[model samples]
Target: MSYQFEELFADIQKDNRKVLDDIEPFEHPLVVLLRKCLEEQEYMLDRLIEEFEEGKTELKDIKTNCSALFHANQKVNPYFAEWKRATGWIGYKDDTPSEELMKSLEERLDEMQDDLIEIAAKLDEEYGESTTKYFIPTFYLPEERVN
Candidate 1:
């Protein structure tokens, strides 16, 4: 069965909740800042959904934008791996994304990552807590090679 974008989004949210629960207490300012960043991501996803349903944007367009966002995340800094993981939920049953769509998605993701990095850096500077270290790397090599 093919999952709709909304369904995929729901899954991402569920995973995000799990991550939040695992973190708990959120004593660190960096953790608080990361939560805020997640909130912004939720807002952006909601906007994408609204735009798609309203016909302001097509599904392909949305997919393209999402792909760009992921690509950008990889390029700017690998620290925001969780964000990249969230985007992976956006996939189709066919398991094949158009090149054009992929390019657009990469671009959008890159831009979003920049915004997130800036937020993280500013939060660290202002709040005096560096939480960037907590971000788990989203990409991994084969177990045989690393371990």
Candidate 2:
């Protein structure tokens, strides 16, 4: 979310051309863009995971009945549904959060999904379905890309 498409792409083009070009010689720019976006999401999720592990937030009280978790989960559910439709990716057990803090993190991830889905749509439109078949790691592709 902190990164912008044009700026990030330009940074990649300016800095990592050799590395990217070497690995994905014929890769479309959109594919490179999507990869970076997913990487950003990965970093965000890693932070959340670290926090959860460190007990930085009190997330164990599930029976307290907070609507925040429900609303956040609701917001994130549809994003995963769309992601499954778009990529045939399923990440249920690995991605679901255990408590309230996770639910909020899921909402944040849902917001980040917009950039990813937009780039994917553009990739599909410009280069066809073949180019849309890029890999999204399980970490970032939580049960719903944030569960």
The number of the candidate with the highest lDDT is 1
lDDT per residue for candidate 2 within 67-105, as digits (tens), equals: 222232233445434433433333333243223433443
Each prediction's TM-score against the native? 0.36, 0.26
The whole-model lDDT of each prediction reads 0.42, 0.35
Q: CA shift at 28, candidate 1, in angstroms?
A: 1.3
Residues 1-147, candidate 1: write the lDDT tens digits: 113444444444444444445335433343455555555455555655565456444434454444433333344333234333433465422433334543554454454444444433432343334332233122322233234
| Clash count for each candidate, listed in order shown | 13, 0
Worst ten-residue run, lDDT, model 1?
Answer: 133-142
Error of 1 at 70 (Å): 3.4
- The Cα error of candidate 2 at residue 10, in Å, is 12
